[model samples]
Target chain A: MIQLTDVTKQYPTKSGPRTILKGINLTIRKGEHVGILGRNGAGKSTLVRVIGGAEPPTTGTVEREMSVSWPLAFTGGFHAKLTGIDNLRFICRIYGVDFHDRLDFVKDFSELGAYLYEPLGVYSSGMRARLAFAISMTIDFDCYLIDEVMAVGDDSFREKCKVELFEKRADKAMLIVSHSHRYLKGTCNRFLLFRDGTIQEYDDFDEVYEKYKELLAEPQTF
Target chain B: MASNSLNSSSEGSFRQSLVVQGRVLHALLIREMLTRYGRNNLGFLWLFLEPMLFTLAVTALWTATRTIHGSDLPITAFAITGYASMLMWRNMPGRCINAIKGNTPLMFHRQVRPLDVYTSRILLEFGGSSASFVLLVMAFWAFDAVALPEDALQVVVGWLTLGWFGAGLAIVLGAVSEKSDLVDKLWPPFSYLLFPFSGAAFIVDSLPDKAREILLYLPMLNCVEFIREGYFGTKMHAHYDMPYVIVFNLVLTLLALGMVRMHVVEADYE
Candidate 1:
């Protein structure tokens, strides 16, 4: 289980302190799949980072009773200078898993084949995304926090992810942050909509997505 | 209770966190080694050799110049001890500053805190310089260019004192560098300015009483003097106050950890 109590995140700018997450109170029970819908610059990523324990909140507390995986994202985790294999090894090392155990699975899942020997800097964006997703899957966690979930890879890769995440790991809890209504409707059992640095929860997908669409069409306000 | 979430209640037992941190540090060390000295000529050999080569070059240049310090201490040993100490303290901060910029992605992992990143660099710096110092001294002894230290354990303690001071300074400066770009820019010239007064160039005993008083204010200079005293023993009169360096180091450690806790979590890469 993961619990966030009155969490707030702020970033300093030339103008002033920008409060991104004003007060977020949330809880994810065992094996619950939660999806968050938000437009750009709405602090969706910040909330996910806080829950994933990658970034600390400026105020309040987040408690995790079960192990949480790192924020699985398209970018901003892998060291580019290291080879794909080396990055995999590094992740395994830090997480206290044997790299040799996950080596085969990542090799087969990423499908970069020989490219895995080369530096991540040389891989194309698609290859990098595949590698990132594949590597994250190898680590076992009670809950997974995914950032920009629907944006990475292509149709086939998405299919692979669906099978690997939903079908294979069906018992695990997942918190996915994305703007795609269709994907969220299919994958998530509950929904959270981001507006004005706060989260509004909804159990029905259609109701939340309708509000999300309204938010997208709403006028700009700071 | 108000506490940083990274070290908060839900992160499991303290022992478990230490185990995780040890694993993270080992991963970071290997990763740093690969990125810094890739698969090329001599590869990671450059870790120790780079410092060793630097000391050798400085020693040769100093020998050629023939610095006469009134006392009859071997110039080779003086240069080696001095240069080695300087490199340990100097390189740590140099490498630590802006360390977040290059390794920002790694921070996405919850275990990879800013202090951990700085620590990995510090360890590398310490390891490299110490290996260089020991290897050069042994090689020189083999060739009969220098004698071994009179008190090996004392020499180790003095070296450790200087390293501790350097590590503390590096952590403080490294954390501060994240707040302002000026620290990164200012540190190089500042370190250079400190070299002439760093006990590398002259003996504390040889200096005039007034000059010695002023130079002793430099903690690094005092440490260098201590190390030399350990090496030369009764032959050279070395003046240093160990308590002073320890107190200064304690303060630096507090500032460093406090600053890292406050600001380092906010670090992000563009």
Candidate 2:
């Protein structure tokens, strides 16, 4: 279970302090797949980052009874100068998981073959995403925070991700943030429409998607 | 009743959290080594080799130049002790100042804290420099260039005190550098200015009475004096107050902890 109480995030801008999240109270229980939809700059990514325990709220508390994974498809955590296998080993060590046991799995799943031994900085963006996705899948977490960047790679890789995340690990909770309405409709059990530094939840996905479209059509306020 | 259970659970989880932190630090240390040294030629050996090379160059230069201070100590031994001690305290804060900002993405992992980053870098610097110091002394002894330390325990204690002082200062600088660029701009010149007075180049006893009194207030000076006394023993008079160095380190450590806590609280994550 994950709970955020009175969470607000603000960033210092040249003009002044810009408030990203005004005041957010959210809770996600086990086995719930939540999809967050928002227009550009609506703070969707920021909200997921807060839920994943990456960013601390300006003024609030986060309570977690379950282990949370880093944002899926995030390649930033890896040291660019290190080999892909070395990066995986480091991540496994930090998570207290045996890298020796999972080594074969990540190597095979990433499908980069000999490239895994090369430095991550040498890999293309698509290969890096594949490696990141494979590593995230190898580590078992109670909740996974996925950003839209998971859409990288070929069609077959997307299918592989679907089977691995949705079919193989159907019981795990997830908070997926994306701008793709069709993708959310297929994956999410519930929907969250983010706007004006706040989130509105809807059980029926179609209703929220329509409202989201309407909001997009209106002129954005500063 | 709910609050009671919550408090108990949190208390129970404290030990678990520490275990998690330990694992994270171990991982970070390995990552630091891999990135810093790489896998190919002379990997990891560079940790000690780098410092040893620097000390060797300085020692050779002093020996060749015959730069005699008022001390009877061999120029080679003097250079080794002084340069090694200076590197121990000086290199740490230089490495730590921007460590967190450079690895901002690592903070995405909840187990990795700003303190962990600082601690790992500081430990690496301390460990590498200390190893180099010991190896240099042993090599010099084997070649009859320098004698064994008069009191091994005193040398160890002095080195540890210097390490503590360096770690404390590094934590404070690292934390402050996160909030402002002023530290980044000023630290290099400030460190250079402090180098002459660090007692790395001259013995405290060699100074005049008034200069000696003022130099005693500097913790790095006291550390160097203690270490030199251990090596030179009765051959030269050494003056240092253990109580003064200990008290200064303790107070600085406390202040550093407070500043680090503030940085963690105010750090902006992307």
Q: Write the per-residue lDDT of candidate 2 for residues B94-138, one digit (tens) a residue.
A: 989988888877867776778889899998888888888998888
In candidate 2, the residue pairs with backbone N, CA or C atoms under 3 Å apart (3 or more residues apart, or in different chains) clash, namely none
Which lDDT tens digits does candidate 1 get at residues B82-197?
Answer: 88999988999998998886666666676788888888889988888898899889988999989999988888999999999999999888888877889999999999999888
Q: Tens-digit lDDT track for model 2 on A151-174? A: 798888888888898899889999
- A214: Cα error in model 1, Å: 2.4
Model 1 clash pairs are: none
Q: What value does the lDDT take at residue A115 in candidate 2?
A: 96
DockQ of each: 0.39, 0.45
- For model 1, report DockQ: 0.39
Q: How far out, in Å, is residue B149 in model 1?
A: 2.0
Q: Assess every candidate by TM-score.
A: 0.91, 0.93
